[model samples]
Target: MRQRRWFPPLALAVGLFAINVVARLIIRLGFDGNDAASGRASIIMFAVIGLTMAVWTFLACQRKRPSDWLLPDLVVGAIAALLLTVLVGPFISGGEPFKDGAGDFFAQIWLYAGFAIVGTLLGYWLAVLLGRDYRSRALKAFAERSKSKPRKVVRR
Candidate 1:
């Protein structure tokens, strides 16, 4: 059976959101009344999410062009995940989205966006540096193939 194109991005979003869910659960159960511990756990969770995106982006860049996967898969998935984390994640922690006010809500969004962008850039840069990205490999192959063929001389 053929798989749908949208499936990947949807799955990516769900996976990212699942990370958030797990973090929330841990924070809720383990650090219920401790603001400091909850803050530390939240930071760790965001870092994990960023790292996940970095690894995902690196692997994706190896198999596909940036134009093919960046906005559609990575950005869309990040946005979807961000929405889920912000809107639904609080429920898991037994709190409302706006319980901490609009400032905190917006801050969370900003942090997610910052981490996502940085992670993606880091992954893509690493791939490019290692010459493992699709474009680099394609260019190297083309150069090698061209070098192997002899150029024809024009007859006077």
Candidate 2:
């Protein structure tokens, strides 16, 4: 097995973090005055995060071993994004991390996880339909090209 490179995962984490920042800023700016609006914005933010993960998953599947990147990358990226959203976001928005109560905190977690799952499924399925997924396209191309060649036998 090859040693895993840090740059790709780090870059992924950074990208996820940036996504969160954008979502947070958007909510803060657009819906700061209303709690209901802000709550909706929060849900939207989670959805965006899921969409990001889905896209990432699709692209990662373009590699030789999609699982190599998909699982670890998704886990790391999700955790990183969750931490930023749960811990740092509240502070940036001028509130205590857990001041809203345990139920609210758990609700946020559930929402984020749910969105990530939905987004990932959407991305994976889309990639498969487009024939752009890593293994699928590779196998398809291999099958097509193999049919064009005549097999030769050699004496051992």
Model 1 residue 91 distance off true place after TM-score fit, in angstroms: 0.7
Judged by whole-model lDDT over C-alpha atoms, candidate 1 comes out at 0.92
Q: What's the TM for model 1?
A: 0.96
Question: Per-residue lDDT of 48-147 in model 1, one digit per residue for the tens?
Answer: 8889899999999999988989989898989999999999999989999999999999999998988888888888899999999999999999999999
Full-model lDDT for every candidate: 0.92, 0.78
Candidate 2 displacement at residue 84 in angstroms: 2.0
Clashes of 1: 0
Q: Which stretches in model 1 have alpha-carbon errors above 4 Å?
A: none
The runs of at least 3 residues in candidate 2 whose Cα sits more than 4 Å from the true structure, single-residue gaps closed, are 1-4, 153-156
Best by lDDT: 1
lDDT of 2 by residue, 1-156 (tens): 135566566666677677767767777777788888887777777777888888887887777466677667767777777777787877767676799899988888888778888888888898888988887888999999999988988899
Q: Which clashing pairs does model 1 show?
A: none
